[model samples]
Target: MAWIMLLVAGLFEVVWAYSMKQSAGFTRLLPTLVTIVGMVISFVLLSAAMRSIPLGTAYTIWTGIGAVGAFLVGVAVLGEQVNTMRVIAAVLIVSGLVLMKLSAE
Candidate 1:
């Protein structure tokens, strides 16, 4: 359950990140609102998950998910570059996430 919350929190992190970009430096209204709301929800869930998961593990996973998720979103939605180096970096981040999860168990 804590893990589920954490995953959801991570996803929400992605939501807020994307919306934040869409917000255009907080100039846009709707996307700005979405960013704020998503940030609140994401923080709440992350706090809840932290009650059970260790702080280090929870934070690392949360950030890792957000980083990778945002990277993918950038590539897919924003049409950002997807070079070999970037791909390798993402893979390394994912590998680290897996290792972190394994260590926590």
Candidate 2:
């Protein structure tokens, strides 16, 4: 399904983001390769999802999911700051994504 593909793409977006950080400006060989592979897979899935879903809607959802997921990962796994503003902003992003999905129906 298009939604499933979008979700997978979003998940890969997070993976690639984290892998890119680990790549250390591409100085690390394994992580850099992983990042490149993840990025390609992510974009491919995104394109596949777009075949069935409206471009605007799919892109917004994909980016929203990826951004929120990555932010949570950074906070929970990387011990990044989970400040009040950041939390509120993330909540807003998720709310907007949900609203978009609902409205698209």
Candidate 3:
């Protein structure tokens, strides 16, 4: 249950991050509102996950999920440039996350 909450929180982190970019530094109204709401929900879920998960592990996993999710969104939806370096970095981030997950006892 805690892990599920953490995953959802991470997904919300991606939502907020993408919405933030669309918000244009908060100049846009709807996207800005979405960003604010998503941010709040993500933080709330993260806090809830922390009740069971260790702070460092949960934070690292949450951020790793967000980073990977946002990067994929940028490439797929936002049409951001993708190159070998970007792919490699993303792979490294995911690999680190997997390692962390395995190491968490």
- Please report the candidate that would top TM-score against the real structure: 1
- Give the worst 10-residue stretch by lDDT in candidate 1: 96-105
2 against 3, candidate with superior TM-score: 3
lDDT, model 3, position 72: 99
Q: Cα deviation of 23 in candidate 1 (Å)?
A: 0.5
Per-residue CA lDDT of candidate 1, range 23-68, in tens?
Answer: 9999999999999999999999999999999999999999999999
TM-score ranking of the models: 1, 3, 2
Error of 1 at 84 (Å): 0.4
1-105 per-residue lDDT for model 2 (tens digits): 889999999999999898888889999999999899989999999999999888888999999988999998999888999899999999999999998888778
Summarize candidate 3's per-residue lDDT along 1-105 as a digit string, tens digits: 999999999999999999999999999999999999999999999999999888988999999999999999999999999999999999999999888878877
Candidate order (lDDT): 1, 3, 2
RMSD of each: 0.4, 0.8, 0.7
- Regions of model 1 farther than 4 Å from truth: none
Better of 1 and 2 by lDDT: 1
- The lDDT of model 2 is 0.92
